[model samples]
Target chain A: MPGKSADKKPSFSDTFSVVGGNFDDAGRVSSRIKGILKKMCLPFEVIRKAAICTFEAEMNIVCYAQRGDITLSVDEDRIVIEVVDQGEGIPDIDLAMQAGYSTSTAKIREMGFGAGMGLMNIDRYADDFDITSEVGKGTKLVMIVNITEGS
Target chain B: MELGFIVKNLKLMVRSGSENLTVDVNGGYVGDLLSDVIANSKQGDIWITRQIHQNIVAVATLKDLAGIILVDNNEPARETLEKAIREMVPVMVSELPCFETAGRIYQLIAAREK
Candidate 1:
């Protein structure tokens, strides 16, 4: 079956608050994105994966950046989420992206997250993952998922 | 035991606006994460948590929960409450912390069902 192609794209700008280092505030952002995807009738599995990825990325912001925001752009064929934060930059992007690698504080681990699976999970779920970090400057993550591809 | 007894024991408020926090809950599960709660909680079980976000409703719906009880006297944001009301899933507010609320609900469920 051929998919419908559209020349026009719908864009949305939404901001969610990430509390400073609070486990309670985790996953709030992803939930919003998930709701948006659901309203658009996207596949449940894809939404689920995106939710998980967004959560880990947002948590990274809270744990390291102290506060952050996630901005999303949805097009006909892809969903692009940009997680930007002014938190301390990843000292080693390679180490951070490695599965089971985490710089979480003890407090975060106690809350049942931060087991070092955040970034790797993001990579596994996102079709495209890019991270730009400076040791002291900050970090920006761009994740693009093509939902119609592998299905 | 009927659901009325459990509601009487906890003195819970029906925040879901479904006309009852009064459903018979068969078991209890407590977790802040939606994924864990979705994976662990069984149907007819009461979910106890302090997360008062809108997504909690969707998780509860997916898991087919009897009701959701927000512990620690936490109030969900207005928007979340509005959605829950629309979903017709009963929500309760309790002063007890998550742990205590879980125990109380469990004891109530077990006692009534037994």
Candidate 2:
């Protein structure tokens, strides 16, 4: 008979570094996380949604925060991600959540994002999202996606 | 040549899936707006645009396109370029604007199939 061995299975995890306001390195973190999720053969739709969510969070780091980190952990039941950034904290989280409220500069607008959909997209895609911030300190985002029972 | 060939001929760098450059382009789509591209771009088709942000990569990655071409000498921000290179997705830069680049790509892909 198997003892405690049956209870332990190999765990899969991934972490990525997102530099602060570094346009040159902006999406690297999200792309890495996206690749691993794909290789795992997770649901295509789910992965796509998560990619959008991740990108929004990643962009926030590049735009608002000086630097950030994205962490991906796949448990038996859910996938959890934490986006931590130390930058000019959001002065008005509620305003930023508004669909069209954007603080993107001309430079950022030139790139075709910053229409103020970042937070909305993240909230829309993730099962749960929570943001904590201090005006001059920084912002911390916690997002989670529940794997559909058998999925 | 096919779209894939044009991507190769242009010496467009592959930022992701470097081993799988053999793309089958059913058609081509060019736009600067991420929403439009996301809404209209078909899977396995080449996408041309001038937007150079990390979001562009996210859009393409999610859209699952054949590749992305930053037309009119447009280059993504350093961070974006680095991400593209790391992802191994194909990206080409050209000095032609939206229309000319699309036309050339169209002609190339069309000529190949015939």
Q: Which number leads on TM-score? A: 2
* Interface C-alpha RMSD per candidate, 1 decimal: 5.6, 3.3
Candidate 1 CAPRI level: incorrect
DockQ of each: 0.10, 0.29
Model 2 residue A12 lDDT score: 70
Q: Encode model 2's per-residue lDDT on B23-92: one tens digit a residue.
A: 6777888887564565456677788888776667667776788778887787767766766676566676
Query: Which ranges in model 2 have alpha carbons more than 4 Å from their true place?
Result: A1-14, A149-151, B5-21, B27-30, B33-43, B52-63, B72-88, B93-114
Best by lDDT: 2
lDDT (Cα, tens digit) per residue for candidate 1, span A1-151: 3554334454655667676566544555666677887798887666656666676677677677867778877776777788888777888999887766777777665554566667777777788899999877688899877778445
